[model samples]
Target chain A: MDEIIRTENLSKQYGELLAVSDMSLNVRKGEIYGFLGLNGAGKTTTIRMLLGMIRPTSGSAFIDGKRVFADNHELWKIIGSLVEIPYSYPNLTVYENLEIILRLRFISDKGSINRVIDKLKLSSYRNIKARNLSLGNAQRLGLAKALIHNPEILILDEPTNGLDPAGIYEIRELLKVMAEKLGVTIFISSHILGEISRFATRIGIIHEGRLIQEVDTSQLDKLCRKRLLIDARDKQAVYSSLMQSGYSLSETKDGRFELLDEKAVRNPEVIATLMVHAGCPPTLLHVEEEDLESYFLRTIGIKEDLR
Target chain B: MKNIKATLLPEFVKLRRSGIFWITIIIFIIIPLMMGLMMFVAKNPAIAAKLGLVGTKSSLFGRNDWPGFMGLLLQSLASIGYIGFGFVTSWVFGREFSDRTLKDILALPVTRSSIVISKFIVIVIWCILLILVLFSTGLLMGWLLDIPGLSVQLFLRFSEKYFITSFLTILICTPVAFFACYGRGIIAPIGFLIISLVMAQFAGLIGLGPYFPWAIPGVYTAPAGTEGMQLFLSSYVILALTCILGFAGTIAWWRYADHY
Candidate 1:
């Protein structure tokens, strides 16, 4: 496996607080790894450690088979990142800000600046000072800086901050193209599961400074609990029939009959036929699978009722 | 060589974009003009008395001539240049924290030590330009007023002393840079500057100026004939050591301290 990014039991601690503990993850070539968490969930800390901005208390982080450390300056040449709210020199114009990054990255291709400006749709605000930019433009400028060098891997923390719905969609498409078409690996973090679920090849959920779960996006549906939600004109009759039939039905708080059995969920049409034969033809028959949000909360043990 | 240019260009851009740069130039320009005006007023005692408190203070220039004018410039450079240079250092390093942009540079291909050293170079260049500006402007004022007893040798001697005094004052700026990074803002380093200025004054009064790092620059500006104001050989050693420690501390903090 071409693991572009890997962490080995990485941990970080301040005086009395364990900010991150034993976080180990791997991102292979061209994989969009979504790091999901709530506030104070150690997502930013882990990113910083990956970028070599903060020292890991134990274990190590590697990018392209190189250990991350202060002296490993060459390692950053192929890595792009935005750890948090991106701030630039407020007094400098957007173009000037990007120019600084280009120079620092030792990128000799001057045309990359203009290409990235057009890529992020920041051409209109190119000449304006960063302080004068709207929050969304400032965010685009940050992304532009990160993508200007066309690095092999990107580690972004809330990359869509301060963006409108359209801006978010555009960036999402841009990141998708960069990953699928250009073979760039991305490790993105966000509190919104629906957003990451759209593009992340795999997802990792963190809570209280621990990696609670990691699952491929393709398997998210299997991981999410599914149930047959059944309603009837004669609700009592339906409940009686389902119980006598050994269906093991349960009544939710809203007075709806629910079947959690895999056979019942998988064969909803069979349940429908049984209801028709029992003379309690269901008024409402549908299968409701957990959404990504509920699944995430349930996975993190924050919302137990949903599971 | 390449890294220095890359880091310095952006720092210079930041310096040029700030309103503070123009303000420093204005202050440097006014320092010499204000001294010239004092000499002009002191020469005419009638105007001096009519101006009341201003006139009485102008009398402190003594002869209202080249020697007196150069004396005033030398003393003010040591006193004011210390504050000015310290402010420049604080603004350069501390603004990164205040603006919250330090993270942008932390993981760059450029070494943190190179960035820190680049900032020090900019500070030195800025401080030196101000000193040269003040010196030239004072010379113009001296010639315009045609203060008496001006000679080539005397001018050279005073020029060398003024340059040396500026150099000494700038040496202590390294500590201000350390405080700027360690304290993570302008307030701490500026506060350190103000406190050091006061402590230097107190040390000067107690005849311990040679021993105090902050007071050594001011003592260097003492008049050539003044008794007991001379800098000791050990004073140069102490200043050099303080500078080394300050620069080393700043580089270490940038290299190892947890930015978050």
Candidate 2:
């Protein structure tokens, strides 16, 4: 794959503390790359350096074969970014804000503005002040603003942080479209495990300013941790059957049964059959595997208790 | 060129949105009205002498009343206009940084210097508009006070003096503009303005106030006579040098300063 963005030993230090250290990353064109990290894990810091918003103490990064710091104006032209939340002049109408950016970029084609507005479904709110928008609408506006010029590369940090469920789904779908149709390589960093997993083709897990692991979507299922759920008609029968199977279930607070198991069960289907044999009619059975969230926690050495 | 236009157009929009643009216009018109009211009240002899508006009235006022009045008023309020300029510059740039709008702007194709220059031009344009408002107010006041036919010469004289004085103000104010860019919080520009005000006042109290940046505003001060024209010309050259040096220093600092 052709690389769109590459960083070599990129590092940033604030006085005595190293915020980002000796990190190298490669993002190929036409790939939806997920940068997963917990809060305060240096993800924002790294993105800031890439966008030339901060100077790295050492090392270098490249965007479209141009050094990030050396050629910021040209590099930024190719990249659209949302660092935290999108902010504009709160008093200015949506159209005003978009027009300012469009004018600054010297984009005279009115079609570009209309296309992005239509794509993000923001035409109705075009005259509304940015301050009056709800969080979901604001997130959509942020995404639209970032996508307005139809940038070839996008670097978004917590893009859907304050969005509702529908907003989240809309963004996920939008990312998929950009990656598939427009061939716009996206670097999205998020804390939500399922959200990134749904759209990202490749995932980079960062913990404490270090790139702990980089895994493809196909390999994620193998890194699963154990979380089992049992749904049976008779609770007593299921409990007895689990005891007989030598699975020690923990005391649960809710109206459901839960068990914490470090030991791997070879097959979850075995437990389902045991419930039937023990006279509990099986309704639903599910095995929750380790996802991006679990993997991030485990890699960062954050205990399940702390989480 | 293209970059300056791109950067400047948005600043006009920003000024329009902030309401300061119009307020400055209103002040330019309204402040001179106070002077007109003073002239009207001078017609009442009983109150005129107490206010000292009667005896001091001279044939000089009859010779060039409108231009002289407008020049005095504009020069008086020049500090106020620049204070407003400082306030606007600080708010405009500071809000972008605090609200994270700078992040959005930097993501565009424009250069950083253009961003700074665009804002500077916007303030200068606002100053120009305010100067026009001052001239118009002066004309209106003169017409109401029953001064004989107002000619274009009056406007030219008023404009030229204000123009020269404004250039001096801009020179003394270069650092204030730079502070607006460099300062982070809401208080930063205000703090710098206060410091300049104090420094200028203190420098004027002493005899050696020429080298100080704040003394540029007082550069044209001369006893009214043939000496005034000579003083204005020499001082204009010195004021031009001050502006050139201050602007050069600001550009140099901007080239090296880390905007982020």
Candidate 3:
């Protein structure tokens, strides 16, 4: 399918509160579509709607052109998902948990369970009950279940909620490989924008129950705001000198001068030379690009309001 | 139909591995054993006197005959079955919510309705096996203790009443499963179990046991034509309605509700 996963103005409401509002997006086959939002930004709600765990109040979601609904069991045969924190039957072993998924998926390969176990590197803990496995292992087990069938499309909501730094990195790399080499289409949601940006092919930032921005990962670096920051001895004098040189400088409350001018940031060496010649040589002069987290917040109007 | 078979394997695996299931089995075994102990005590007063409080409780059985023993078995199945069967239904359904695994099953290749039907199937198997355990243990204890009135006719009558009581008790579990899903955890369903038990007692006392869904099972097992314990064909109709509502409600909730 050209658009393996698509939503058309999907909305969910509870009484007066709108959990997801008129949200629409599409993920091409083999693309890792990152869904970024702050806590309670309707990421899970949207995922749930896509999975048909909850019905949309206003619009619809479709997987492989089939409209999602609880009874549309055929659509889920090739789709795998992990929504929110992953949970299994606590008493069942990790192998048994994945075995359950395999059975439900109706895959006849008895050895596929072991293959996923090896794929997730859970061989040692295969026989460990779900309750005894650490949070990271539990997460791996969840991913293992999602990938056991080698689905064409995978939908995950905060799949790395309880993983350590190493675990997160490993999972990110694994997801990248799955999408790049295996040609799996992944739709993953997370509050951590920076992490999702690392591997997501395209990203949609949601805020206040609405999708505010969608951008290609290749273009994300350019979309992040950048500024030329200048700080020197006699800062007021340096600010005055920059103003004298026809630099459109804005003094920040932190006593540093900032320049949003594209030219200044592009040629920062020229600004240093200009500052030294103007009798206030810069002690600190560098370009500051906004991090993904701040860019995410700004895109959502949370960080922008502060400025 | 194929989807149900697929869903059933996981349900059975989960049930098989749970500690609670074994505990339930042990409880089933122990109830009948305790009843047999009471039968033994009633047969021998000298041994009863030496037992003190145990003897006092055993005296509550009223007779040492096969009929009296069957009476105890029927009554115990009603009350204990209420708690036991309800618990099995609760754990089968509620563990999904308590453990937060409900979401994983919802969007599967198997339909939610199939998942629900599979769980009910497991509960049915669990209730039926438990009754068999109780009955088998009761027979063994009766043979070992050699209680009087051990005719084939008595055995057939008691077995038939026991099976019917067990069936009714299992029927009531449908609502328990509904409560488990509606309430979304073991605690809530168990709470509902307790409330129904209390309500059964109240309804039974007011001569309305035949009408209340929870009371109907207990009324059905009320000692083979006991004057006050009359169950009309209408009683089965009411109980059937409760089961239908509970079953349909549970399935609908799974299909339609926003299970966050």
All DockQ scores: 0.73, 0.45, 0.82
Range of the 10 consecutive residues with the lowest summed lDDT in candidate 2 chain A: A257-266
Report lDDT per candidate.
0.91, 0.73, 0.90
lDDT per residue as tens, model 2, A101-200: 8898888987787788888888999899998988777877788878888899999999997887887888889889988999999999997767798899
Model 3 docking tier (incorrect/acceptable/medium/high): high
TM-score pick, better of 1 and 2: 1
Ordered by lDDT, highest first, the candidates read: 1, 3, 2
Across B1-260, the per-residue lDDT of candidate 1 in tens digits comes to 88787788888888888888889988999999999999988988899989999999999778788998998998889899898999999999999999888988888888888899999998999999999889999999989987898999999999899999899888999999999999999999999999999999999999888989999988998875666578888999999999999999999999888777
Model 2 docking grade: acceptable
Question: Candidate 1's residue-wise lDDT over A1-307, tens digit each?
Answer: 4999999999999878898999888989999999999989999999988888899999899998889987688788888888799999999999999999988888888899999999999999989999999989989998998899998899899999999999999999999999999999999999999999999999999998899999999999898898999999988888888888889988888888889999999999999988998999998888998898999998888898552
Please say which candidate is ahead in lDDT: 1 or 2.
1
Residue A107 miss distance in model 2 (angstroms): 1.7
User: What ranges in model 1 sit over 4 Å off?
Assistant: A232-237, A273-283, B224-228
Share of the reference A-B contacts seen in candidate 3 = 0.86
Candidate 3 lDDT, tens digit per residue, B160-237? 998998998888888888889989999888999999999999999988899999999899887667866889999999
Interface RMSD of each: 0.9, 2.3, 0.8
